[model samples]
Target chain A: MSEQQKRTEIGEIGEFGLIDQISSKFTNKNSSTLKGIGDDAAVFGSGDLLQLLSTDMLLEGVHFDLSYMPLQHLGYKAVAVNVSDIAAMNGLPKQITVSLGLSNRFSVEAIEELYKGIQFACEDYSVDLVGGDTTSSPSGLVISVAVIGEVQKEKVVYRKNAKENDIICVTGDLGGAFLGLQVLEREKAVFKENPEMQPDLEKYDFIVKRQLKPSARMDVIHELGDLGLVPTSMIDISDGLASELFHIAKNSEVGVTIYEDKLPIAKMTYDTAVEFNMDPMTCALNGGEDYELLFTIGQNDFEKIKNHADIATIGYVDKRANGLKMVTKNNNTVALQAQGWKHF
Target chain B: MSEQQKRTEIGEIGEFGLIDQISSKFTNKNSSTLKGIGDDAAVFGSGDLLQLLSTDMLLEGVHFDLSYMPLQHLGYKAVAVNVSDIAAMNGLPKQITVSLGLSNRFSVEAIEELYKGIQFACEDYSVDLVGGDTTSSPSGLVISVAVIGEVQKEKVVYRKNAKENDIICVTGDLGGAFLGLQVLEREKAVFKENPEMQPDLEKYDFIVKRQLKPSARMDVIHELGDLGLVPTSMIDISDGLASELFHIAKNSEVGVTIYEDKLPIAKMTYDTAVEFNMDPMTCALNGGEDYELLFTIGQNDFEKIKNHADIATIGYVDKRANGLKMVTKNNNTVALQAQGWKHF
Candidate 1:
């Protein structure tokens, strides 16, 4: 407790390193806790089924800018992100608890508008808003959401079960959300320079919606269930595709080889990347917050989803010695890197 | 959406009113969600047993001051308060997820110190640390904890089931935690005015510890189970005795009458209240953050706990027409008013 004691800055370790350092100190004490601290959601037992619990905390200024982010969309995004975690485990979300810390600057009507979006997400996802705590904050708004979901024991998927030669697939398009953020930031800067100028956003509507309100790919989960396919490993693309790929590769003890030509990108996302003078491929690889599902399945199961318009088989799992690599459209090989969102 | 629209301040409706306003908009969509929004914890059927879910959020500056409050105790208290909500439903806490938003000011060692307390609480309560999110905050520290517990379907208790003439009981002592806060605040002021002077806290150690490290009454829960005693209604005392009394009265549609002479106050708490020129009785009635269990048992069940040392019978439930009243030592009756913590 002395001032002279050595101090290690949190930024040095970063968020993931900090989590590893803390989670390593404790061990699970309950038999019912099937898995803890390493997956998209914690797994537990409930009779014949397995239950999943996941939580996410979003703070103002850190997660979103209120000047451009609507209160309703923020609320909806909060729920969607938690639901994405549940879907990562191939589980169906059933209940959620939202805790909010509001400063005096907020009005009751504003909070109601926030909850209106929450209610909309609840109805759309068919999950119940069960319990939560409302408290005061000294500065800014903080929203923390915890969701509970369930999956049959046989259908439960984890991030550590990918096998060599497994087909890697990603649902929906990527990089749109990140490009949307670029547009919003650019527009904000322009407005600040001249307050009288009204923003022209009609041309960027698709990418803007992707940033403000991205939906969880529950449809992909349902389709996979109907196709009788269980992914060997799965994760959601919240910290960009490359970072999520790193997670799966590390946990599964396998290497990955993705093809740049096979990566799914919407027209608007590619155009926005060009407009910003950024590489579209880099944006697709590292632009996060798309909330799409990334999974690996047995090669035999590839045919089941190959014809599906929403899913794209972009890569294949390999031996650990191969590491993670990407094959460019111009026949060049490169190492995959992750430049995820770094709040610290 | 207009500048001319009326803006209702959150303070006008208060925390409870805001919760009620928001929760009323959402309806339960899942059959597994047996109960929601009104209880200390939400109840659902996991399988044969009922499951309970609850969450609490604590923000720095609003909930605690790091200038005096230790990081370790804050971590322990965060877990204990959430566990107390589980105990209120007569359930056994099995797992908890703790999400933290830390700023750059907190060092790695400081975070480790905080987790040490979290680990200690997990060991003491026999609950597993499951999964959580660690993100950076723009300012201060934010902690959001979600707990899941289980109870037999028949044994689960709710706040609205108290019958007329039920004996109202409270466990442990009251006002100590509140008085402890007052003592800490006074000492903090003294130290602020004169940095060279050491705080004279030895005499107030008992109450101070009560404030810093209040334990959840899980021992009482186990004892009740062993004695085959199930209270008709139950709740945890977090927002003072009077506010909790109002919840029971309003939910159960019953009245309450308690004797002031029967209120239990620790000697240290009473002396501290007197030292601070505050009424000890008012402290017991309105001072919050006690984290004790409050319940009402049937008359026939009272005999089972009559000889218990920690439990005290303070009052009895009455017809709704009687309203909530307290009889003072002079035998004068007065309507009880709740001045619970107003955070907004």
Candidate 2:
């Protein structure tokens, strides 16, 4: 409490380091709190079915830009990302609460448009918009969403449950959302530089939509349910695949060995990354915001999903001493590095 | 869709109007969602025990000034207010998720101080800190909290169940939080005008504490349970007494009548208001952020809490035709007007 007290900058610790520091000081007191700060979603309850809770906050200028991002897409993306967290837990989202802090610059109609998308997502996910608080912000919009989901206790998955020989799989694709962001940024720059010039977005539609209206893989969750498959470990790729792989490795006390040839990247995403003079494979590994499902299934369950079209077997788990590495198409082995999104 | 299109400003409809507009467009698709919107908390689940979910967002500048409001109290208050929403539904809070948007101006220690307050509230309320999202903000701090609680299906209270003859009651005193804010703002102004001037806060400790660290009335909810009585209707007084009374009336389809002399007001709060050249009774009625419980209990349960030390019987519910009126100490009746907080 002194003026010359020790001061540590938040940037020095970064996001994950700060999380570890904060979580270290606290201990869970409730018996029903099955999990707390470490996982994608907090788990609780003693019944055969347990509840999951997760929240995400998006600031207007930091997480989005009104100049290019539509309010409707922003609303939809907000709900979708939270829904993705529930899906990552192998749970079905039942209810969600949205809290918004809006400045007076926003019109009632603008808010209506935002809610229209929220309603669309509510219907799409079959989740109810239960309750929220709307208050005035001093500046930009602040949207925070909290979702409640339920999963059968026997089938619940955590990042720490994967075994040494589990198979790693990713659904849909990766790098598209990140590549989509690059295209949008380029267009925004062009539009800002010359107001009279028309910003051509026709060719970038696929990646643009990937960034703006990315869907949570509730479909994949349902498919997994139908396939009668439960992953030993699961995570949503919101912060790049390599970063999440590190999480799985650290939590599960295992190493990862992925093949570059097997990394899921759409043709459009690859071509766009190439057009931007970026490595396509690097983009797929580090370009986050895909909201794709990344899970590890035991080898015994591999026969069930191997022929599935949307899913790609990307890697296999290894012993903790093996470390995380990738094998290239040329048969060269290299260490995998994670360039995760750094908010700080 | 065009620049010439009609656009209604949010100021025209205010906060409640915006909420009504949003809630009207959405319908519950999940059978587990027993209640959605238009209440202190959303109720879900079909079991003998139902779940409650509620969220609140607090913004810097609009909600608090860091110059006077310590980060610790801000964190405690952020949790307390959300827990108050659960208490309003006569439920016990069990889990909470805190989402914080912070600017780099805050140090790691500053965030730790903030979390310390949150930890204190978690201990006080016996609610587990389940999950949360923390990200960088462009400007000031933003805090959003969502809480999940549980209540017996038969005992859960709602805003729309007050009967004509139910006895309206309030716990603790009112207007103290508002008076505290007045004192703090005055002190801030004084300090700003003359940096050399030391704030004389000793005399205003009680009221000031009320503003900075208001406690949710969970204690009263426990007491009511012990007395084997459940309120027919209830709401937390966050936007002042008169405003909340109107909510109960509109939701329950009943009228409200209260005695002016029966309204609880702390002596210090009354004295501080007088010093500020403000009406003490008006502050108690229209001054917001008190976070006290206002409820209506059946007359048959009157004797159960007749001599309760903290609870004060203010009036009785009335037929809708009677209108909302207050009987003055001078034997004159005046229709109550709600000068609620206008965030816009």
Candidate 3:
């Protein structure tokens, strides 16, 4: 680098812009690569059953605090988060490879506790723990997981497949995980100020668990399969609902019209957000790490999932000109903004 | 975690020991998971074409020094290392997902330079960069890559498949990479002590390049396919010749016997080792990061690869009771110990 050469900070473009720049430079040469770069998982294979590959990396200080998080939940969340990517593709996770970079600060027993959680997740999701590389890190603990999944070729969904007037649906409630993180941070701060503080986490157990060991919405995918319902478009809500809607809208070349009143927030999550003096709706729209499913289905397929207990029909897809907007209880419409979990 | 509990350091078990312990506690539940935990890459898929999944994570301070290693070379090496795992399994890499943790210290242009090397490697090795996650790191740069590969189910090789009397062969020379590291470190120390000193790395270019950006032997894998020869078992030589031999021996339930005279050491590597007062043979046996191929072919297939220039006939498989041993040019035999690249 010469002194005259201009340097651009990564924060200038944000992660999505950087991703787009990187993905645009490469082209797929293999025919088996049905899809790449844009979806939750990369799709490949020539058989009737296609394969899904996705990876996620969590650094110790950046992604987790470890002060309030047990190694067990950290391990479980790492697997679940990768598994959620497969679910977002309407695929069943078959196997995962975990690569860890550990510091000497972690003992053998501590590492075993982490693996125990991974084992539990394997059993719960019916995915096998196959291969991984474990090495030493200079500083914090690092966990990177890559998962393989399988889905019927015809049933596979991408973020770009939504059609106009499609019914938008979300599995389970949102914002709980974000609130859980907030509560954990608050408690950690409290504990730091007073060593005798015991965290008082009993009152916030549900939300804290949501952050620590959020479940991937595999159940919703299986149920959709059983009902013979296929989503036209799908995405995992790791970056909050509003941000994910932009992904679908941009990829599908369609606009979204979600009802703010239709959004589902758990009773506890709603009350907890209020306690923090945060608007529950804002938390639902912008708070992330939910690991829930946000997807769109054709209007005709909505009948099949209409009465489902966990699935909520939030809104409908519209024309690109309409843009992404939400209808509030006061009958006013406003454009949706994504504030998608920017670590940069 | 309890008051009376004992904590064991990970160094006590070492990396292989920790991996074995973790692998023993888990069992494959998915029938699609044909080979898991023990192989170079996890094998799955039910079709005649089997799928291979493998991941490797590299950290900044632990794996390389940016003081000498350019980011471009780092990116190239990261992808190549993962691709090597696929080649070790007798498979061709098709697609890869890279997860990176970057600190603010890097510019967008620096990342682009890094990706330039990755793109070059992708073109060189014929692999696709399908998906990845890039986030802010709290400390040093982190790179984790997972690759997906395909091979004929019957042709896929595992470490446990070598037979008695098999001819052991290695692709290219060994010890160059390890010696390259010694030169770089020595130059770094010299330069650190006196600011005016240049590295004077001109004569050591070949060896230094070997350490900075070693190539994966995918070319050899392709050549084997063209020659209609498949090794009974295979493993990439990332952890030196003797250590990899032990892997092949232990996994195959056999023993190895290699002649010291036949060990292929490049002229440059041998000279560099001598310059550092290190035994060239010891450098070949225990020095790591070579990224070459070590495998065993049935005695009948010797005619197919016997005349190959890049392949060296170094040893042969023996009975398990015989143990891993090396015969010196002086007509003396010694047990080979694997001081596999240990960071712990």
Candidate 4:
């Protein structure tokens, strides 16, 4: 084949594939590096305790739209997403460094508003704002946040530790953030077509807020610690429930079976999806940006969390031969498909 | 004042002023956070050892010109700059997270080339490529790198620890990287005017390579450890010697006096600046991105490194009343001015 033919577009392999291809070439050389890529966060040993590091970058047009998303909420969501990565490792976030690239169009007051949100998130999560680099971008705004957290050696959880029969649990609700985006987009289109039209967004406030500012499930992480329970495997549901479940199954080398009825969706989200002429169950399965915690625990720990109101038992681990499947309320079993957020 | 009149443009306050305004509002709340802003890197305590964290973001048109800079070297420089931050803190970097936002214009082959450079730097610095986020960009490429390092509690250094009698020291020569950029820009302009003209860059290879692949002075950091010496105050010369010295002076609350003749400049850099009709001394003092170490050692401890070939003692700390001055070769004591890289 010619050299030109050998050049594959990044869109061909997708984001996860690109990450795997890149990270696979790098081998960890330091003994302090307890874990590298292929997890929610990298783990490193600093004496007796383990330290977790995770980073997330958001670009203006790709990850968010400034027209509908306020700068403050953007800043808050950036920190919250990174904190969620730490929470996925069952760690407490302590410090964060936020880097930003702004165009000349951004005023000092605009940045202050963004930082106001960042400060609020920092206070909410109790994470200290440490250091970062601020530079000018040629075009749009860019934000990258790196968070460091601490977890005990015995208590640290990874994505590759699930065993057969482990119960799958997800915290809070799902799909609200995705449905929120839909409402915002619809309103934006209407406003764009006719400037005189005022957006009637009061009804979809909850779902819209979920998209604008989704909080990380650090509270659930704290509650698990208080209950003396550690998840066998855990991950944050940023890329929809099916995609995150696929990550756990792929990493732990196990099959998953989730019941459709057990999936948690807020009433507002379901109603909004119906108003948009979308299936609520499909949104729950494939919509992204929920920022919820999806974890698995041994069956013995089930009794301890079963009585909890926010925790829901969605599924259980199975043999790899069974593959990933979901059972509908009508008792029809079908193969689960992961339709994650595709930026490309 | 009206609310609209109160709005301040970022360019008016400049980058440092904006940073000061933002970071000043944040107070570190975590006990583990030893130090926050106003340094090359933030200091934190992780068990018995102290950890350092630093992050840098590079935007496509702002930080580099893809026409001249290879993706591989851009990747290498990104990691090197962050590693320099760790070295400034007297720490050994163990892990780094690199996040990238790419547009569709880049092919998978382009990304592979970039990662190859990242891998090379990882090997060179003995740092593990830990975790990062990859997403699509709407316009150009953006790269953000975060590094974590460790130093003994007693050995960790800060910018505010210089003494009045401390001897100022610098590693390697300065201004090469800056001149190198000038040459590249000239060539780019020439090529744009006439694509048929083959650019001649072989003569400026030394400065060009310096611009493309600047290495962090990790060797000096290791040698300092071997000599059983710790800098009283230290900072990496990323934003020019004058700017960095001002950082030391402001943070340490001390005046600085340096000899103009003592400044180190490579023959190539000096000659290149002369050819460009720029002052060579000015370039040496104000041209940034040297990636060299600027540190202060107490007077009594200077004897150990005074005779070293790579170590140049350019000045000494003085009383605050003296202010920051540079004694020119003509015996004129002039106040030093910091012309740092301005993006806004």
Which candidate leads the pack in DockQ?
1
Clashing pairs in 3: none
Predictions' DockQ, in order:
0.92, 0.86, 0.89, 0.90
Candidate 4 C-alpha lDDT tens digits along B189-282: 9999999988889999999988999999999999999999999999999989999999999999999999999999999999999999999999
TM-score, candidate number 3: 0.99
Model 2, range A1-344, lDDT digits (tens) per residue? 68648788888999888888988877888787899988999998778888899999999988888888999999999999999999999999999999999988889989988998898998899999988989889889999999999899998889999899899999999999999999889989999999887878889899999899989999999999999999999999999999999999999999999999999899999999989999999999999899999999999999999999999999999999999999999999999898889888
TM-score of each: 0.99, 0.99, 0.99, 0.99
lDDT, residue A265, candidate 3: 95
Q: How far is candidate 3 from the true structure (C-alpha RMSD, Å)?
A: 1.2
- Give the Cα error of residue A124 in candidate 3, in Å: 0.6
Off by over 4 Å in 4: none
Model 2 chain B poorest ten-residue lDDT run = B1-10
Candidate 3 lDDT by residue in tens digits, A1-344 = 78539799999999999999999999998888889899899999997999999999999888899898899999899999999999999999999999999999999999999999999899889999998989899989999999999999999999999999999999999899999999999989998899898887788888888899999999999999999999999999999999999999999999999999999999989999999999999999998899999999988897899999899999999999999999998989999998979899
Interface RMSD of each: 0.7, 0.8, 0.6, 0.7
Q: Per-residue alpha-carbon lDDT of model 1 for A1-344, expressed as tens digits?
A: 68748799988888889888988999998988999998999999756688899999999998999989999999999999999999999999999999999999999989987888888888888899998999999999999999999899999999999999999999999999999999999999999999998887789999999999989888899889999999999999999999999999999999999999999999999998998999999999999999999999999998899999999999999999999999999989999998888888
Q: What TM-score is obtained for chain B in each of the predicted models?
A: 0.98, 0.98, 0.98, 0.98
Instruction: Kindly report which residue stretches of model 2 are placed more than 4 angstroms away from their true locations once superposed.
Output: A1-4, B1-4
Off by over 4 Å in 1: A1-4, B1-4
Give the local distance difference test score of model 2. Answer: 0.93
Docking class of 3: high
Q: Kindly report which residue pairs in candidate 4 clash with one another.
A: none
